[model samples]
Target: MDLAERIESLKAGLLGAIAVGITFTFTVFIHQTLTVSNNWVLPAFPSSFEDLSAWVREAVAFGSGFLFGVTYRYIIRQGENPHLKSGAVMAFGLVRGLAQIESISDRFTSQPWLAFVLLGESAIVFAVAAASIDLAIAWRWIKPAS
Candidate 1:
């Protein structure tokens, strides 16, 4: 790809990353809130936004977002295919969700329900990221790679 095309890819990726990061963070906050209010008997995840581990969680979320964004931009390229877009989102979500399930299984508490919730959360986050990227592209804020 040419230098300009690479730059456009970077722009698109950055936008996607930001969208994913924000969505992930919001979901986490909601999860924490629900867990706290309901006293859900899930595995010991960070249940409070004020906890020290929240920083680590945020970092991981955004780092994952950056990776997803760059890959997703390349996957969809300049195509307007809805299948490609939805497939990309599902691919990322399933990978993340399955990993979480495996991790939960390794734990003694074995909160399978929590894992499913995480899976759904992953899908939502990716969907939001994809939609945001599409909107950005349509608005000419992010030109897909040529």
Candidate 2:
């Protein structure tokens, strides 16, 4: 690709990353609120912000968003309009499917309901984040892929 094209790709990727990161973080906050309010089952999250696991989870979440953003950018570059819907379907489908494995595993045998709730929450978060990121790009709030 030419220099301008390369620069445009980089800008698009960065925009996607920022959009996804913010959206995912917001969705996760919503999920946490719901979890606390409903007393839902959750993995043993660190109780303290200073805990290693807490930071690790934060990093993982952001990393996941960044990856998703990059992927979404590529998808949009393929001439997909209604990009938000396409990205949401792809993102949520993959996340929900992967999340189901834990919910169906023998590990959650004693509390299948917990697994169900967790899976539902995951679906909601992924869908919201995906839609938010794509919409931002579509609306030019985020730079489009060249």
Candidate 3:
């Protein structure tokens, strides 16, 4: 579908999504800043950007926005109502924050037990993101797309 058509049903609601745009912009900005800073003359990630597990963690954190957006879009499609701009933004923000927590948790390494613990912690974060999106819609803050 054309970009316009693909998002057509939800465009207004997508635009209504308010925080969706800002969240993505900030995510990209942070990713770029981290990438540039990590590769700066000082170079904290001596393992190279490719090998830095931190980058992987960062990637998951950033991807949270996509999952949140999917939920937000679905919310708009199902709720049949629009939401307070700030509420929608904040809702997505929460989802992103949860993702950040999960990403950070997954960054740790050392023991098998620690890995399992971190995995569960990160999964919880992702679950929160998904749940928030579901709740944001269930709460009727975002209307279903027409």
Candidate 4:
């Protein structure tokens, strides 16, 4: 209703949008970069080495974006709440990021630059999502205690 609340809500939407966009875009770019190269390949991990593993990886990479929307909203809330601000968004996101980076990175070593760009993009997305994550926590999109 108020100006501040309006601004927060708008920003929340933007952060969520950005998170989903970054996750999907990065995954696609990484997938293209790897698949285009017939030499470099992804190693077997949770599943057996097969085309199915690659497909699953593709799905997971894209799905990781879902977390970003929530992650960013919570990060954004931190600035609004002193309590949330005290807790570190980067540190918190670090845990989530591990899976993200690994899930996304495993299949992209074929094109070193593409992988690097993906990483750089991830950092920017993280920065954006961190702010949103603070907000999400403050706004109750995610648990404050988390």
Predicted model with the maximum lDDT:
1
lDDT against true structure, model 1: 0.74
**Winner by TM-score:** 1
TM-score, one value per model: 0.84, 0.61, 0.35, 0.37
Task: Using lDDT, rank the candidates from best to worst.
Answer: 1, 2, 4, 3
Tell me the spans in candidate 2 whose CA falls farther than 4 Å from its real position: 2-40, 44-50, 79-106
Compute the lDDT of residue 63 as modeled in candidate 4: 48
Q: What order do you get sorting by TM-score, best first?
A: 1, 2, 4, 3
Q: What is the lDDT of residue 41 in candidate 3?
A: 23
Estimate, for each residue in 1-146, the C-alpha lDDT of model 4 and write its tens digit: 46655454555555555664555455555555675675443332222225575556545533444454444444544446644433433443454445545665655565445444444444555555555555565676544322
Measured on C-alpha atoms, candidate 3 has an lDDT of: 0.45
Question: Per model, how many backbone clashes are there?
Answer: 0, 0, 10, 22
Residue 10 in candidate 3 has what lDDT? Answer: 48
Q: What does candidate 2 score in Cα RMSD to the true structure?
A: 4.2
Give the higher-lDDT candidate: 1 or 4.
1
**Alpha carbon RMSD to native, model 3:** 9.9
Error of 1 at 94 (Å): 0.9
Estimate, for each residue in 1-146, the C-alpha lDDT of model 1 and write its tens digit.
Answer: 68887787777677767887788777776767787789763443456567777667666667677777777777778577888888888888888777767656766355556766878888888888888877877898877655
**Clashing residue pairs found in predicted model 3:** 76-143, 76-144, 76-145, 77-144, 77-145, 78-144, 79-144, 80-143, 80-144, 81-143
The lowest-lDDT stretch of 10 consecutive residues in candidate 3 is 40-49
Instruction: Give the worst 10-residue stretch by lDDT in candidate 4.
Output: 40-49
